[model samples]
Target chain A: MSMQDTASSGVALWRLVADGIERGIADGRFAAGDKLPGEMEIAETYRVNRHTVRRALAALAERGIVRAERGSGTYVEAQKLAYPLRSRTRFSEIVGAEGREPHGRMIEASEDVATRELARELGLKTGAPLVRIEAIRLADRTPICVSTTWLSAELFPGAGTVFAATRSMTKMLEHYGIRDYRRGATRITAGIVDATDAARLDLPLGRPILVVDATDLDLEGKPLVTKHSRFAAERVEFLVEP
Target chain B: MSMQDTASSGVALWRLVADGIERGIADGRFAAGDKLPGEMEIAETYRVNRHTVRRALAALAERGIVRAERGSGTYVEAQKLAYPLRSRTRFSEIVGAEGREPHGRMIEASEDVATRELARELGLKTGAPLVRIEAIRLADRTPICVSTTWLSAELFPGAGTVFAATRSMTKMLEHYGIRDYRRGATRITAGIVDATDAARLDLPLGRPILVVDATDLDLEGKPLVTKHSRFAAERVEFLVEP
Candidate 1:
């Protein structure tokens, strides 16, 4: 099961080393944005020469598993957090399972009239007042997602105050006497990060972001909230289970 | 409801125009990479002035929904094709459901010994012979995905030939007496396109690509084939339905 064990096969030593490093990445031995070990260290670990380690690093770079800076050592490209979308999915639990601390910061919150699209999504009439909560979510202090969530203002009158106080959606919903909600439909698209999101996410311009348009429903199947989330694409991977 | 009908609401006219145009993009009235009509035309359609239309377009540009090309008007940024990843998802059917033609081309097909990663994915011993199929898929002649698939060579011999003849994975499986197969786990990540895929997908360098690592399972719940597909992130979206 080790990368070195596969070297006995006909595959090149460099490839095996590269594959091993990649496996390390996939399994989280090497975190994204973390500087890779020095070439001498890798060579020693793999029982290979520095030249072979160099070749392996090059291959990894070509595949975008890692990137090399002119002066800095090689670093894993981005975090690939396993994010699962399920009925009872909880953001805090998901990040916790990955051994990372999850933090949410409220950027802005307001009560506004729902736009036509928002009304249709939340099953509210046009011009109905809604509470809009904008927040940035971070995994272990690394900003990863910026989301805007809208709920019926009439139903969740103090939603903004609750969210700002708790910094947790699930907790905020609990304060509304609703303890159970499930994911409805999730639509995942991608786009280049806009300026505002780039600043919020601390991502460079032109980086791709995964746009998630999702709905949450209460125990009675009534739409509870409509959320628009933009995830730093490189930092997370969605795991879809049947 | 039409965008013009929403004008009666308190929202500004320019904002209404922008929302309408965005809706048009979402509903496929305008496709990815398609240039927008002239300002005069858009104004006429929305019953607005040229200045109002210009402001709307600018808003769209700021949101990354569309990009303005110098002297050539504005263009819809990219197509957002809805791709559902289900127990029985098919590429051609998904594309066709979106009112676009689906085409597949075999870039290369060969018999190769499975590497460690490939062996683990296909549940085979390292060095086991396997058939590798590399293909590019398109929607209405717009390249969208490039995938590499691996099957146990001993179990399904000449899979490449069947695939070349049918241009369909479902059909290829049929030739191997697999009347039905379902999707297993799917991992979705995003990265910038490399040079080879950029050319194959007719995309510019640095554009984001969705990396989908998936498995096909036979009726008996055995792994059949493993697929690695890279999609033009802007052209397609994955719909995960509960």
Candidate 2:
């Protein structure tokens, strides 16, 4: 508290240091999972008291930027695979962009009646039988994403066999003659993981996950794929293109 | 552990109950965040022991399907989101599909030499200056996404003025007599939030954030926009056309 520089309006010296660290984060000078220098080192570098540096680092810990190990120094949290926010990239492709091979396991492929949400996406009557495919996408043998796709059964029969052969739902649709697909709109939200998904994805339930609800369309604007994907917050990402 | 029907093994009863609930989760019968029945009630309903019910619930938790809170029972985890794996679309349009008005806070807009990454994207020299615009994008009023775009300054002279107008960056380019852009490949990654970015976006540092890195080109195959975006996990998504 004795150390004083310029802006001494009682804003707290530690806070100023914390602000600088925050800027570093926003500007990408420091990346995720990176470790900061030791408290004594930071104090010397910033010309501040060691306690003040501790206070700044403490602030960071509260904000979840740094993880404090009692005897050891703090560490940045591990990051997940991100989705491109500004591009037209597929989930499988984004995973590869992150340098991880993308592999999807088809958990269940069956016909079921459309529920309220599926009906809206498919533009089908409620309770209409539809083909539902539940698949889990993995990276390095770790399950990171879970998806459920509902398709109009009337549009494609025996899609299961085709999908089983090549593992490309898109190609299977083409084999059944519904080839053209233009991108469509999506609905997005954040939700916590629940019991069953936690088991399948091997995640702790109550963990927050990204929810992307999307509908694909044909050249004629016909609905093609209506899928709901649950991604582990710490494991996956969505990118935006500009 | 001792409770079971004579004909069926104890483990079988648990599996059956687990399957029933798993089916509900897969079928969307028990939506994310929906509370599940109590062990007693589930046992009565599924015709199994309470121990069987507990085992089933435990299994679900392991799969990230449900979370049980003491005195509050179990609830479904949030639904998963699916981001695309391919390269396509623009950033503004991607968020637009999420049904939100997207806007940005212009941070830096200047014509400077492209760095190594930008040079590779624009097929220019390492020191070749590009029109770089940095902004923090907001969804509605909440501060969420951050993006930086680099456009070849050689192609556009007064590109700095693009930030002055509220017009979209790409549109601003079009107004300057440049039109049409074809997207190229993009890189996506998921990592922990750096202390700096976590502060700017008002996110807790060390939390998982999504990132998308990509370059764009025009009809003549001249590079247009090289964008890198960092997104908070809860506020972003990507769509797959296929």
Candidate 3:
């Protein structure tokens, strides 16, 4: 039957093709990392035109089930990185434990007055002096997240210089006599990446990003730092630990 | 200046309009539940065409920052529901604690053989008899999530009937002499809503949804149920408790 004939069955043609391929992947007919059939081949097999096949592939790509390479054909996406959310969550440790190289680069650092929202989060007065740092974190050279962190400048003077020397937030805090810290709270919301963040993370505009608004507390339960981090949703999945 | 003149400043007209309105919302000029300016008024204010303003509004709606009403104009979305992720996560309790009435309806229920993935998740043999239940949960008359849950039929006979009567997995399991359960592990991912889910949840197609894969274990840490829940990303934000 033609594609239009199948549409009469109450399912869209493109959706049928997409569901067929998804079932194949689930059944191990198309294994992980396996390149999918070309557009012309999929069209022939489904008795649909190339445009229908392309639409199916686009849907799959948007779901993060498959990825289309620039030169190569479409391929099934590998397992996403499982990021554990716990009291002592650490980015470098999480990526390292996953057997991937973790890297963080400071994009910009400056002294600034805390905004009303930031001040409330950090339990400080608005316009309080703070050290603001913008950084990008990568795993295996793939950009995963971009974070903007704010710290009380009075507590950790010259934190930017220390952080620049050692690309580790823990190490920088340690230099300031803070030995340990834990996650205070984390609020996660989903949003589309804006143009500025899209360019910084090398992601396309309108792609989904997980926004994490978090605070870290010192050993005495005092808020040490407040951060806003945006993670690429397709590259990582947060595993909530209780 | 004309829209073309503003577009030459390295940003698209639609994005500029979106950013302008975003700033207005952030600065409290447009509070939550406030109706946005009409398309013609926005076009006149920004000196852009109605099409560009519509595209900007569409982008905002996609991000869930603003919602469009069919007959009424657009309005900023209210604060998202904060869903806490913990070992003893209870959906009804969560909504009730937030001062909202919780409701659930069974969409489909049947006895089926466990697939490979479901078998692995529940530590059951492949093709084992399973009771599958599909449900949609709502809070304050708004649909929040659609879930598919599977339990071993051998362990919980007549679970489908019990769940249908109770409209709750917890209550249904209690009827089978299983009193308590805890969340074992949760895996979260983001995806666009498909046609079936969009229709069920009253969401627009291509909007983002948070897919949560979780397993609930009994007192002895034996897997009792495996569930996949798709939440409306725009209506809720998950708070990971540590």
Candidate 4:
């Protein structure tokens, strides 16, 4: 049914306007990063008052479908990064394939004893030495995710040093003479970014973040590393490949 | 590093308290859906004032990590539903596997002309006749998602009627003599729920929603149906399998 028909059928008028604009974006009438028309224009087109149009725009902004600038008009938000979850998933490769420059910075690297949860995930003793590397990954200079990776320090001595040099787990694994690995398992959940992640990812407080707890395995299917990565929900989405 | 170490490393006092509580939850000291300690108790434990404790709880509430009840204390939110993405994905099966009763209710159904995007997704000509069905799916009587599914009207005559009777797209296809289908492709993104969806899903306005745009194919690998499903991000997270 048409937006007007829905509005006439008891749906809120402002909501109908919001849905109409959303449909426009979906149909490519308003492309990503394209500025929306002014409030007066939208009001006239939707046959609603400026107040209703303002409410509609507010709703869109709250949804993150559109972003409003102080001096500029509202613009459709950038398209989300389409991250593919595959057997051989690689962050650099994924971001590169999307035609975005990928960069990583090590925030902290240390050797520590595994906690009970970390030990269970990595199949190690609770007191086993673990090399933990905390890092933030960026795509085109936009912070996309913050991750903390843990590995058995016994397996890869000096892992923190190697990772600090390479800033990539894959490259550091190669430095350790392990050539190939695959995704073992991933558990996904949605949560608000904690204070630490919010600052690291440059995300607004309380914004949704996609939490992925994953393990990687060596060619022999032995667990190599367990990591928790939190992606800014507005900037990236995981595409699960069958 | 320890919580105290981070707390002393220049983070805000209130944030440190929040992180400590979050760590407690992660370590199973505070289980999901459990009421947190009283504000006074937490304040004393964290060596902070009651105002700081209240701020920390407010931050947690905004993050969807914990919920505050009127006249009662704040409680940890329930664990998310892990919905796996695989070739032969089935919603009912997923929810049932999670030990929850799956239910679907038809909200709207009609014959409609395909828009360009819909036509491309369904492998039909532009303006082709299609049957559209909008539904709300619940797990354990709690609304989890709202979906809109479309199929070729010529290929599946009476699809709307069959789906209404069965409350299942799989069953409706089965009624048309197609027993098996597989997920062809799925694109997932995160967004704030629009007004209609907020109302239908019984979610608060501006809550995060995980949008899954997917196409299903028959055994012969021909596209049979296309759908857009919006899951409540707080309630469910999609696990994409390789």
Best by TM-score: 3
RMSD of each: 11.8, 12.1, 5.9, 7.1
- For candidate 4, give the lDDT of residue A114: 92
Q: Which of 2 and 3 is ahead in lDDT?
A: 3
Residues A1-242 of candidate 1: C-alpha lDDT, one tens digit per residue: 24355312223566557756865776467887989999989999888889889988886786577998877688997446789877788888999999999999999999899878889889999999999999999999888799999999999998999999999999999998988999988888776665478789976444567888899998888899999899988688888887
Please give, for residues A36-151, the per-residue lDDT of candidate 3 as tens digits.
98899999987888998988888778768899997789999655578998899889999999999999988999999988888988989999999999999999988999999999
lDDT of 1 at B184: 88
Better of 1 and 4 by TM-score: 4
Q: Kindly list the per-residue Cα lDDT of model 1 for residues B1-242, writing each as its tens digit.
A: 24364312213456557756875786577888988899889999877888888987887787578998888888997446889878889999999999999999899899999888788878899999999999999999888899999999999989999899999999999998999999988888776565468779976444567888999999888899999899987688888787
lDDT per residue (tens digit) for residues A1-242 in model 4: 34444322223566657766876776478998898999989999877888888887887787578988877898997466889888898899999999999998999999889989889888899999999999999999989999999999999999888888998989999998899999987877666566679889976444567778889989888889999898987688778755
Angstrom error at residue B31, model 3: 2.5
* lDDT of each residue in B186-223, candidate 3, tens digit only: 98867656657887898754446787999999989889
Which TM-score value belongs to model 4?
0.79
What residue pairs are clashing in model 1?
A: none
Candidate 3 regions with alpha-carbon error over 4 angstroms = A1-30, A35-48, A55-77, B1-30, B33-50, B55-77
Better of 3 and 4 by DockQ: 3
Query: What are the runs in model 2 whose C-alpha is more than 4 Å off?
Result: A1-112, A129-133, A151-199, A202-225, A231-242, B1-104, B109-113, B138-144, B152-162, B165-210, B231-242
The candidate with the higher DockQ, 2 or 3, is: 3
Range of the 10 consecutive residues with the lowest summed lDDT in candidate 4 chain A = A1-10
List the pairs of residues colliding in candidate 4.
Answer: none
What tens-digit string does per-residue lDDT give for candidate 2 at A1-242?
Answer: 24343412213456557655654564456677777778888788767888888877776677576777877776765345666643134656677878998887778899889878788888899998888888888887778878888888887776666776766666777797775565577655455455568778875333346666777788778787788877775565455443
